[model samples]
Target: MAGRIAAVSIVEAIAADLRNRIFTGDLVSGQTLTETDVASTYEVARPTAKASIEKLVAEGLLDRGTHKTARVIELGPESVRDIYLARAYLESEVLRRLARDKAVPGDAVLANSEIAALQSGAPLDVVEPDMRFHLSLIDAVGNERISRMYRSLVGEVRMCMVRVQSLHLLDNALIHNEHQRILELIESGQGDAAAQLLDEHLGRARERLVAAMGGTAGPEAALPSTLD
Candidate 1:
């Protein structure tokens, strides 16, 4: 039992480090990882390294082809559009609910503060905080299923952010301002307006990312315009 526990811990630790490497672009998209290479680098058994890679694969970060080697998943234009569209739909509903209930998410405010603190030019620095702010808004809805669905897409979301930043396409100050405005609109009980702004905010980011990835933005998909 003790050995099993220790092995699980080691797997988790290795997985965490590999996850960070993917997020920080140390492991670029389409780069393959062999179990042997990971075992040698981390000084772990091949099975342990395999388990770590499998964990990331389950999280949607790593893709294992038929050959069973893991490679970082690429976020092409279609992927970028779908991810942002899903996020916009999910978060738009959350905003409407929060607005109707007049519930303000404090964690979102804290995340915005973190975003504000970063230097304006460092787009990568704000990605996690920006993601946190949106996650906080969804969590504020207090629906476990909805939050789970949203989180399932987060790995791809972070990958998209990394690409967006690398292309120098994000504006830190603008994001902060937009986040603050969305919160204020929710606070004022303006559900529809808040949802609209949230949709527009996400839509712009999605289109820009799609365009940067060499894809044309399609017609806007409609979200629920009002709370149920």
Candidate 2:
């Protein structure tokens, strides 16, 4: 039992480390991972490393081979578009429901908190909080299935964000302003307008990520990876 627990811990640790590398783009798409290399680096056994890689493969963040080889899954244009499409559908539904039902009395408070956290120039836990904010809306809809799927999708989205190295806290005056506006629309029961604003906001964010990754943008253009 002790050995099993230890093995699970090792595998989870390795999985998290590799996930971070993949998210930060340090392990780019198509980069192969060898069990031998990972075992040596993480000081774990080959089986443990294999387990870690397999976990990520199941998460759709890594691709596995017939043998024990694994590689980071690359996001092509279509994959990117599909991701946004899923997000748009889910978020728009949540927003529409919230506006119609007037659920979640603290919309303004949550939005203000997020904006203040972003503007404070402090390292924001953007990924987790972003997931929470969106999920909160889905939960308000009282749909178990949609919420479950949204949670699953959030994991994939986070993986993509990590792959693009786009979760850092930075000063995007425009983003801050945009977020504020969306919050205002939601608060005022303008579901349609809020949904439109969210779509545009997410689109701009995606564009900035692509531009930053392609080296078309300046240093401040890319999202930072560090929590702080």
Each model's lDDT: 0.85, 0.67
Would you estimate the TM-scores of all the predictions?
A: 0.90, 0.72
Task: Give the winner by TM-score.
Answer: 1
RMSD of 2: 6.1
lDDT of 2 by residue, 1-228 (tens): 998998899898889888777765678888998889898998888889889988888877888868757888877645665786788889887787777765553644574467456533222245545555566667777789997787766646776555443544234445456656665676678899878877766665565555545534334334442222
lDDT of 1 at 55: 92
- Cα distance off (Å), candidate 1, residue 4: 3.1
Poorest 10 consecutive residues of model 1 by lDDT?
219-228
Q: Tell me how far the alpha carbon of residue 206 in candidate 1 is from the true structure, in angstroms, after superposition.
A: 1.3
Candidate 1 is scored at a TM of: 0.90
Please give the TM-score that candidate 2 achieves against the real structure. 0.72
Per-residue lDDT of 22-101 in model 1, one digit per residue for the tens? 98889988999989999999999999999999999988999997777799998888888889888888888889999998
